[model samples]
Every structure is written in structure tokens, then in C-alpha cells.
Target: MSSNSTPYYFVPGLSRHPVMASIGLLGFGSGMTGLVNGYSWGAPLTIASVVYVLFVLYKWFGDAISESNSGQNSINVDVSYRWSMSWFIFSEIMFFAAFFSALFYARSISMPWLGDIESKLLWPTFTAVWPNDGPAGLVEQFSTMGPWPIPTINTLLLLSSGVTVTWAHHAIRENNQKHAVWGLAATVFLGAIFLGFQVYEYIHAYRDLNLKLTSGVYGSTFFMLTGFHGFHVFLGALMLAVVLRRAIRGDFTADNHFAFEGASWYWHFVDVVWLGLYVVIYWM
Candidate 1:
């Protein structure tokens, strides 16, 4: 196939990646189930599966990188990749939507319905207010997190990182490699700082505020939302770090930098999600 012209299609040969990824996922799922059931080998098994999956990812992406760097990728391939990444991000949006929907349902509908006159007749003392300690007070008292200090700090950090990443994109487009490198490094640094603040907030929530996952619906929603977002932040930081490494190695250029673009898109999506969380979960 001509490198300059779009080929009919760039069909890859059969590979073991799909089966291997499935095996790894299965093992990981089994390990998690076992660990939840208190099995001794569960932790080790989970670690093994995770390592396997990471290794597979490394090899798989390495091959794709080699293809791209070797000029095997055409405009068609680039377009396909862009579409795939867009769809992937859309799927991620739906994933977060489900969680956000659950949060809304719990707060707006379920809580009030449970606290209403008829339902409260069964449990007379159940408070309708949010962050309550449940009907029987089985859940321990805990303070809810406010959109202050650490969370606000994280919001700022993410916003700044967005700006930095955008600057990096612009620099790359302008063929200013040095500025691109600096911008990427700053973005990664900001992401790391955001994660640090999140970790500190979690520690404070558990220790000082008595907010555990079991602390009632409020705590459950709080941790579920924030914890998943934390994971996404870490993943986005890792993605940016990879892009930064590639930038330092002169991988991306003005004409071809979809990998960097994809990472930036993911990072921006992460930032937007956090903004939603801050307003809904923190402020609201």
C-alpha cells in the first residue's frame, strides 16, 4: 500500500491481544471476587493479572507506535484512530453519567421518599435531611465534605493543567518543541499535585471527619464519585507523562500528533468531569 495515498483498508493480521486481554480481565475479576470473599490468594492473583494486563498494553501499544513512527500509518488510519478515541471518550462519558445519575436519584428522589410520612411511619425517627445516619442510626455520624480548601485547590489545579496542555498543543502546532516540552511537563506536574491533594483529602475525610464508605449513603456517594475521579486523574496524568516522553523524543510534529491530541482530549474530559463533581457533589 502507498504511504502517501489512502489504502483500501489497513487490516491488521490476527493477533493474540484480544484473547490475552480477556484472560487478564477474567483473572482480575475472579481475584477481586475472591478478595471480597476473604480468600488468601486473592491479592496475589489480582496483582498478577494486573501485571499481565499492563505488560500486554505495553507490547500492544509499542507495536502501534512502531508502525506510526515507521510511516506505516496513513491519513485513513489517523482518521480511524481519531474516531475510535472519540467513541471511547463518549463511552467514558456515559460511564460517569450513570454514577452522576445515581447520585441525583439518591439525593432527590430516594432520600425524600424514604423520609416521607408513610415510609417514616415504619421508622419514626428517620430524618429527611441529607448526610443522615440512616433510620436505625446504624451508620456512624460523619461530616460531609464541602467544596473548600483541598477540593477547591484540586479544581484550580485541574483547570491550570487544562491550560498548560492546551499551550503544549499550540506549541506543538507551531513546531516549538522546547515550549511544548515545558508545557507538557507543567501539565503533568499540576496533575500530580491534584492527586496529592485528593489523597490528603481522603485521609482527612476518613480520620477527622469519620467519613467511611460505610458511613451511610452520603459517604458512599462521596467516596464513589471522588475515588473514581481520582483514578481517572491518575490515568490522565500517566497519559500526559507518556506524551511528554514522546515529545522529548521528538515523536509528534505539526502534521502528525494524534497520540498527543488523544491524550489531551482525555485529560480535558477528566477536567470537565471534575468540574461537574465539584458543583454537584461538593457545592450542592
Candidate 2:
């Protein structure tokens, strides 16, 4: 540990991580309150909240980076820290898996049963349709989305982004800095374009097809799954953008590029989730 740092290898001071985090959450909650309340200040409230949260995250991660690069963090500490982060990411995956599983079961088993002998009497007028069947309780009509155009394009975009990130990883390993930077730049651009197209799709859904969060059971699960996955995509893209900036400054070496790898894995996970969503939500 450094003379300025503590025995546990952390910065020797009363950390503001907790207090700052609380403020960020409070800002977010207040902003959500305004949004749900549908007030004039709702947009501002949410904007402030997002800014606060981003600022807090910046400071939190910034501190950790300083702690690591300042020689206070040992190799032993780094290994242990990596294990902890791995398990944490695993837990996050499990959390999302539960949601995805519920979505699967609801669409496959529950919806089918509702239109069958188990609840046929209850839903006397409802037909056993694949797309519109919401749940056993609320039998509403909703058009199912096909994997013909928008979804297929999105899937391809994510797949290509994954390939580009992998290329960047390879370039870094080979010490081809220019190629790696180009790859990162391309990945980030593709990610941005993917988001833009997804937004266009959402608008098309609301306008032409009348698909939305309140349309039916299909709409609910579809938005939840795809929306969350999109948020992850935003995060992955942001991370990749930052990595590109770092690469421009020669901040990372081939042997110590865990930051780049982490971003790649995260983007791949987002891609995988989108694939599952495409099959279950759009295809079946």
C-alpha cells in the first residue's frame, strides 16, 4: 500500500461512494416520480437524475482506477477482485435469466393452455392464437411481430458488432494499435446505428402496427426484454467508446487490456440476449 493509502489498499479517507450513490438514487427516484406523475417538470427531473447517476458512476470508477494504477492494489488483490467481479456478473446473468425464463413460460406454456381445455370455458370467445394471447387471465388481442425485416436487421447488426469487437481484441493482442483503434471505432459506430434503427422500429410499431407496452401480453414482455437489452447495448457502446479514447492515448497494452475484454464480453452477452428475444418474441 502507498503511504497515502490505507492498510486495505483503498484510499485513506472517508469514502463518499455510499453518500454519493444515495444522492444519485434519490435523483433517479424523484425523476421517476415526476415522470409517472406526468408533470411539466417530469422531463427535467429525469434528465437531472440521469446526469447525477452518470456523474456518480464516473467518480466511483475513477477512484477505483486511481487506486489500481497508483500501486496500492497488489496482484493478489487484483485476482481476488477479478473473481468477485466474475461472480457478480454471473449473478446478473442469473437475474436476467429468470426474467427471460418467465417470458418463455408465459408465451409457450401458459398462453397455449389458456386457449385450451384448461381455461377454454373462461376465455369462451378467445381463440388459441400464438401472438395475441397475453396470459390465462387477460385475453386480449395483439399482433405478433415477424422476424422478417427490422428484427433480422438488428440481429445482424449485433452479430457484426460482436465480430468487430473480437477483431479489435485480436488486433490488440498482435500490437496492431491502428487496426485495433479502427475496429473499436467501427464497433462504436455500428452500435450507435443499431440504436438509431431500433428507435425507428419503435416509432413504426406505434404508428403503423399499433404495437406498444400496453397492447397485450406480447407487448409487455417484448418491450421489457428488448428495452432492457437495449439499455445494456447502450452501456456496452459507452464502454467501447471510452476504450477507443484510451487506445488513442496508448493507455492499454496487449497484456493488460481487461477493460477491452470486459466490454467485449458485455456486448456479446447483449447480442446473445437479443438472439433469444428475436426467436421467442419475434419468431415463435
Candidate 3:
């Protein structure tokens, strides 16, 4: 493509990024499987695969940035990108929905059925209850996590991040680079602090509360929901940081900043998920 002429529909030449990303994902999947099944090489392989994946993403995104900066991305391409991001967020919604459904089934339907008059013959001592320890000493006794200082604080942090990210979006749209940078920086900082508090909460769960993955269905569900959400938060924060870098370099204009908008979409999604988790997992 020439610098003076813009294509009607921009399509770059074939690249190896797709295959490279696939290879990284394959390695990551294999490493995770090995780690779960107790292989000595699993840890190193997982770490290496993560680094490789990050490297691939850095290069892939760099290429896209260059293309955008070169005016290769047309309005059609922007629309396509927006549609892709919307679908991706929808997929994420379904992912969380499945977990939420499982929690509901376990708590409302299955628990009540098991504790009813019919199943008492099979397990006489069993009681259908929230945060159960399972039948016949199958699960370890552990205290439940409640809506307390740590969870409440994390909720406040994420809520604050949502506001800051919105502020950044508005700032970017108004071409206020300074406010945009500060807003993004604050969002990232809040996300980091939220993750830190989550780590402390996990430690407290293990060391003081005796709450672990082996504690019961409750423990597994709690960790799976919150852990995956935390991972999303990490990804969102990373995206914001990248956008922040771009903002500092004056890469975004009043009308041309899908990257910032996309990152904000994801950050808001993360914030919403945490709110659900706070209500269902902690308060309920």
C-alpha cells in the first residue's frame, strides 16, 4: 500500500502471527495439563509458554498499531473491530453465566433435594446447607468468606476504577491528553491494588480460615469465579497501560481511538463481573 492512497477495504499481506499465537496457546494448554497432573517439567513449560505468548501478542499488536498509524485501517475495518470486540465480550458473559448457573444449581436445587426426606436414608447425617462440608467427612471444614473489609474494599476499588476509566475515555474523546493519562494511570493503580488485596484474601483464607479448594463445592466455585475475574482484571489493566502509553505519545485523536474505547469496554465488564461476585459470592 502506498502512503498517499488508502485502500477501500484494508487487508494486509499474509502474516505468521496467527500460527505463532496458536503454537503458544498449544504449549500453554499442554503445560497447564501437565501441571494439573503433577509433572516436574510443567512449571518451567508453563512459564516459558506465558512469556512466549506475551511476546507474540506484543509483536502482533505492534503490527496493528503501525497499520493504524499508517492510515491502513479504513472505516470498514473499524466497524469490524468493534463487532469483534462486542462478540468477544458476549462470549465472556456466557462464560461467567455458566459458572453462575452452576452455583445456583448447587445452592438452590441440588442442596435442597439432597437434604430432603428422600436422600436421608443414604446419608443420615448429611444436611443440605450453604457452604457445606460434604457427606461423611469427605470435605474439610472451612469458614465461609463473607462481605467484609477485604471484599468491600476491593469492590470500592473496582467501582472507582470504572469511574476513572470512563473519565479517561471522556478525556480522550475531548483530546485532553493529560487528564486521559492520569485517569488511565489511576485505573491501573486501582486494579493493581485490587489484585494485591485478593492475594492477601487468599492467604487469609488458607492460613486463618482453613478455606481451600478442597474445602467443598463452595470453595471450588468461589475460587474459580473470583480467580478468573482477577485474571480478566489483570488483562484489562495491561490493556489500559498500553493505551496509556499511546496517549502519552499522542497516538489518539478526538475521533480515532478505538483502542482506548475497547480497553474501557473490557474494564467496565470486569467491574460489572466483580459486582455480581460481590453480591452472590460474598453477601449471599
Candidate 4:
């Protein structure tokens, strides 16, 4: 085993996976502690910490890329990488599923039973309602996000981005490198704009509609489902950006384009999830 040409193409010496995971876990723990304790600066500090950590991660992965492209990732290493990525994506699916399940349980079980006309002796004031307004009843008697304005716009943006990614995929398969790069760039830009509008919508909800996270069960579930979906959208956009960067360098060809395909697949997944949210959370 006369190895030493590249750092990651072959097995490097013992690595620091544990230390890195611990750093992330510690940051999360402290942030959550402050949040639960009602510290004023908790949210801002947590966000800053995450941005710093992301910067560290970018530089670290860049170094690994330098090694792998230099012939470090051999056949065996590639196999392991594929398996790791598969499991990681599977884990993400489970994460999103939990939120969806929460939504289903709330709408189907809790609201119906609580509002049942039969429950006169129970929750007399409660009525089996589609939009429960707020659990604590703090919100100023409002309507849902609705399918017309912000939500519909976001849905179109996500759906169009999905189509663009598919176009980019086909272009790569046909060796139309320029189209692939430009299509991916457009998809990434749309995702960022969608995120921007979503943030603006949140501000409107908080200030104008009196719809904060603490409003009640309605607010809680609404934000939990949509907020998590928004975070996924942000992540998918970043993935597309990475794919576009590689495309610009002429790195992917038809048959050897799993990297781009994987990102595209994830973006499509996000779009599908958003469609569900738009219908359930917004319209009905």
C-alpha cells in the first residue's frame, strides 16, 4: 500500500468526524437552551453561529474536492460515497415525513374531535372547523394564507424551478453544456427569489395579521409545516447552485452526471412537498 499521492482519493489517516459532529451538536444544544429559556439574543446568535459554521464547512469540503479530483476517490471510495449519500437523503425524507404526519394528525384527529357538535358537554365553545384560527385564540380572527396570493406565487416559482432543473438534466444528457448551465442558474435564482418573498410574507403575518408563532395550535402547525418546507427550499437552492457551478466548469457529461441528477431529484422533491403545503396549509 504505497499511498500518499492525494489526501481523500485514498483513505487519509485517522480523521476528525467526531470532533466536527460534536461542535455542531454543542452549538445546537446551547441555542435550544437559550430559546427555551426565553433569552432575547438567542435567535440572532444562533443564526450567526450557523453562518460561521457553514463557512468552515465550505472551506473544509473544498479541500476534500481538491483531493478527490486529484485521484483520491478510487472505485471503492466512490461506492462508499454513494451509499452514504443514499442514507443521508433517506434520513432527510424521514425528517419531512414527520412534519407531514404532524399535519395530518392535527387536521384529521384533533380538530374534528375537539369541534364535534357531539362534544357539547366537552368543549362547548369549540366547533368542528377547517381553520381553527388559533388554539390559544390569540390571533385577531383571521383567514388562512389562501391559495391566491403569496402561496400561489411560491407554488408557481417552485414548479417552474423543477421544470428548469429537468431541462438542465436533459441538456446534460445530450451534451448541451451551455443550456444545462444556464438552466441551472435560472433555477437557482428562482429559488432564492421564492425564499425572499417567503420571508416577506412571514413579516406580514407577524406584524399586519397578528399571526405569530405563539398564536395557537393553528399558528404552531402552520409555521412548523411551512417553515420546515421553506428551510428545505433554501437547502435545495444551495444544491442547485453547486450543480450550476460544476456545470459551468464542463464537469458533467451525459452518463456520468449523478451529482447533478441527485440535486435535481432533491429539488423536485422539494417542489412536490410545497404543492402539498400550498393545498393543505393555504387553501383547505
TM-score of every candidate relative to the true structure: 0.93, 0.85, 0.95, 0.85
Runs in model 2 with CA error above 4 Å?
Answer: 1-14, 29-43, 133-142
Off by over 4 Å in 4: 1-9, 116-119, 133-140
Q: Residues 184-241, candidate 3: write the lDDT tens digits.
A: 9999999999999999999999999999876788998999899889989989999999
Q: Candidate 1: lDDT of 25?
A: 90
Prediction 4 TM-score vs. true: 0.85
Candidate 3's displacement at residue 33, Å, is 2.9
For model 4, residues 1-284, the per-residue Cα lDDT tens digits are: 32232244476666564467468657866875687579976776677667766666666656655655455555566667677767877887788788778878877998877766676565576666766763345456754565668888988999899889988989999999999998999899999989998998898888787776666667777888888788888878887887788789876767556668777878888888888888778877
Report per-prediction Cα RMSD to one decimal: 1.9, 3.6, 1.9, 3.7
Tens digit of lDDT per residue, candidate 1, span 1-284? 34624564566778888899899999998997787578998999999998998788777877888878877888889889999999999999998999999988888998899899999789888888776778887898888898899999999999999999999999999999999999999999999999899999999999999998788888878888888899899888888898899999999889889999999999999999999999998888
Name the 10 consecutive residues with the lowest summed lDDT in model 2: 2-11
User: Model 2 lDDT vs. the true structure?
Assistant: 0.77
Q: Give the lDDT of residue 78 in candidate 1.
A: 88
* Best-fitting candidate, scored by TM-score: 3
As for TM-score, the candidate ahead, 1 or 2, is 1
User: In candidate 1, which residue ranges exceed 4 Å CA deviation?
Assistant: 1-8, 33-42
